[model samples]
Target: MGRVKVLGACPLDCPDACSWVVTVEDGKATGLRGNKDHPVTRGALCVKVNRYLEQVGSPDRLRYPLRRVGPKGSGRFERISWDEALDEIATRLTGIVAGFGAEAIWPFHGTGSLGYLQGLEGYPGRRMFNVLGASHHAATICSVAGGTGLRYTLGTSGGMDPEDFARSKLILLWGTNPLTSGHHLWKFVQDSGAYLVSIDPVRTKTSERCDEHIAPLPGTDAALALGLLHVIVSLGAQDERFIAEHTEGWPEFRDRITEFTPERTAAITGVPQEQIVALGERIARTRPTAIRASQGMQRHAGGGMALRVLACLPGVTGDWAIPGGGLHYSTSGHFRLDDAALVRDDLLPHPVRTLSMTRLGEALLETDDPPVKALFVIGANPVGSNPDQRRAIEGLSRDDLFTVVLEHFATDTVDYADIVLPATMQPEHLDVIAGYGHLYLVWNEPAVEPPGECLSTTETFRRLSHRLGLTEPALYDSDEELARQLLKGHDLDRLRADGFLKIQPGSVPADKLQFVSTRAELAGHDPLPDYTPPADKGDGLVLISAASHYFLNTSFGSNPELRRRAGDSTITLHPDDAAARDITDGAAVLVSNARGAFEAVAEVSDRVRPGVAATTKGRWAKFTDGATVNATIAERDSDYGGGAVFHDNRVEVRPR
Candidate 1:
């Protein structure tokens, strides 16, 4: 009879797992706002999420299951019943398994939802896929490279808590623009009243606000880090006691950095020698200095090495023993969830090959053992998110591939699907989320009923399990059961009563810091910190496909207001680079490389370095000219994990 409020959490692939409150009236969500009680959220939501109601109520919401009626990529479909769609999907999957084997079926997913029950790590379809002996999906498009790199030096990605940033004396924002992506972390950095330094090739919005901005040539972060460490050691500022007590292989790491003098580092990184010396001095003297190293910096060929070297900074300075000191690449390591229970990989028939999601094109087209015949897409849009857009689209266009997509809207990936199933959004689903930014476990209660025929991902997989004649009990577990299983040891009662709960008590332990890692050596890499320049360094301008302020990796690419605010698909260029090619501000230009090319409007500015060009990612093909910015990106792997090299490519930008 009246409006009521319900507690939930933002389920997007963001660091801030913001606890939010939804106002409901007549079983429909009327309004949503950030939870003021949450420390990181602080009663604020990002600009992109402020208009989320429109996204849920958009006219384009896919309300019913549909079957493709036209050729692939035609976006033509006819409405179909759930039974019909599931029966057809089951029939096709059975045929593919009979002919090519279960390895031919790829259940591709991504970070669209970070919910433990429905999102990337949750594995909503993992049980059925494991029971059928399906190939594993290596979700490496995001933080894997950095996480692996951090592991080399620290043994874990867990580092200084973001809440402890308020205790820091200095903070380094390395290749991250919190104003655009991790805004919640910014509040702590500001609260510390610490000297802020932004280290990035692009003079981002956050960089402009920093106390100092140090622009280095992209892909040379390891050299810069070593150079800084060299200066620290020369100044005799390294914590000898910390090195002797907590770290291993310090002698080798120290010797390795001896060659990375300020002059030598400047030559490689394009940062001025004087600035490097000054910043190095500052870092050496500053106590409890924290570095917020995000995923953006580790998206290159040598991404893992870069993070490894950077992580050594705190260990050298003995900052790891302080409240605010350490490197934070990710905080997911702190949450000890029951992963075995969540995915149930033990049910797999036998060992199956794992395919890299970063190299989706190769998995679908060039895979020889059993070529991918069926693709089940959930919580991701590859055409807009994956690198090598040309190859991914080509593979998706294959007529023989049986594709089924579960989505809220008809995305670029949906066009290539043989069957499109409408899936419930966050407000219509129950999930438990852990923030990679903060140390909180959030509970998301379903606020509204699913619109039209939309079903939750867990429900969809359960139906598929039944339709496939599978009798696995775990596969058919209810949402409540799955949640209870995932939250076995955690204080679920407090979390439900308060909407959130801190999973851990304090900052990372001092013993967690290690200067050198034998694990890296065992992996055939140098055990000590070092720099390796990217192999793709040619005489062309470097391309930086950075994140957008208004979109979360293609999740909000369809919002009209957000799109308008994002403006045209534009490439930002240095004034010198623009003048060299006779390109003017707001002029249409073409960015091309050996991989592929796309058109964009030019914005001549000094935001980027002379030899670098920048563009925001998440432009859908239909949003622009049938090609997204990813067309120019290669599907190359980083050194540690098979992470995509999104920022390691060289491209040519010219007037169209």
Candidate 2:
């Protein structure tokens, strides 16, 4: 019996790029643990990832290629050879291009594995799709709105390093609950000894631990930010020197901020005037304050504007010049991947229309010119995660639509596929991983051979490209070649030895905190940092479908242990709202809107505001009734970045 430890990195769709050690005994994985040497990992894995071995070793994992034998969404398939699967996929895609043009083919990708080679951002099928002139997929489900807004103000989303948060005297957890979703960064927050404050609509686990929890109305973040700025300027806390030297359009912005006084902000945000005043005063007095604005906060109709307004707070206080004082949305901009070399967009024969993934149902159902005939789903389950679930499912049910999915499990999206290819998991594949939460890139080494005939996404695409008989040299590049191309000008040996590479943040004067007056013009917004109210105000409680602690966007949704720990799909409402609806805790309820409906167990609590209903996302349709919270969300786009408005939804809750 022999035991060995292999170094690898996590490739899940998380901000923390965790470095881990896999314990293998007799050629089988015995255990897995975090690398204590890595500052972000700190020798611990989150609750979701702690039980990842279950996911890797699950009996339900797809080990062989499948061809659907029953109707769509039947979850019935017959085992097939890789040659059969790849041949069928290539033939169907070629037929689709010949009959309906290449624009009919959509390569739908997602952030299942945030690796440079296998994930959505890596452009998994870029060379083939571009060479074939297929329609472009706009990846805007997650942080695009917030990142776009931050870029307009700060010229980049990269800001204060997570390690520098320990130097802060005040830390504002703005719409981000790092303890549940991103537990690694909490170590630095704990070490900071900072007066922590949580600004969210619901009292999350992180909020309960914070020194202050200010529950504002949903979709009213911009109002709260403007109100804070109003108080800062009123108290003469504004840094005149920084504003003069570093900012733009302050006079106009100040004039706009004046409109949002404490009383007005309290009315708009549903936060008490006194609480707003006190928090504003605290912000004015606190030096080296850090604001961590997450992706969830910018998932509303005015989400982009909300981020733009929140980003101005640091400039108003001159926190940009100090350590642990800037607004941190993401550190992804620092990692410069050779995207042109990898994506090969130059191979395109002509310009192709870009379709938004957020409005996937529309793209699938309502698109007219060259209706979508072929869908190549890569590492994404849109039927379970995308908005307007009914339309997505209905569109997928089309008998004429030829669909192919690359997945590890029989996900909701896989149920509707014509060909389902089994893909390798993190431990069974090689990838170059980067994180948005911190500044580091980890080389994910394959710890074990893939089970059965499973293949990595890169290998799958390479094989499919060959089966198509296309002479695209870039499409046939090896995984190692792709990794080296992405890690250009970096030490490969050092990266392999250390298991990670630190990406130094870019050094540019324009990268500093600076507001742009032209930002409002880009999205037809206000002249200055202004509040754009939610489009829908007509009815019942505002629904917020946030990230779950047990699941990472349907990645581990099939794990029995994780599912048991997560319990049934639940919707948490304030006691007052529950009483008004004549609903009791633990009762089955129906949450419905104009878009659709779903079933959930009601949890009556004071954790959420009266007019707000809260629930965690990423539950499978089979786990719940026939839909998840996504069913109730409309196909609406944010004011900026064409992002999904998941939080801008309104729904009614009643006894089932």
What TM-score do all the candidates reach, one by one?
Answer: 0.99, 0.98
lDDT of 1 by residue, 39-110 (tens): 999889999888988999999999999999999999999999999999999999999999999999999998
Considering summed lDDT, which 10 consecutive residues are worst modelled in model 2? 507-516
lDDT of 2: 0.88
Give candidate 2 misplaced runs (Cα > 4 Å): 507-513
As a TM-score, model 1 comes out at: 0.99
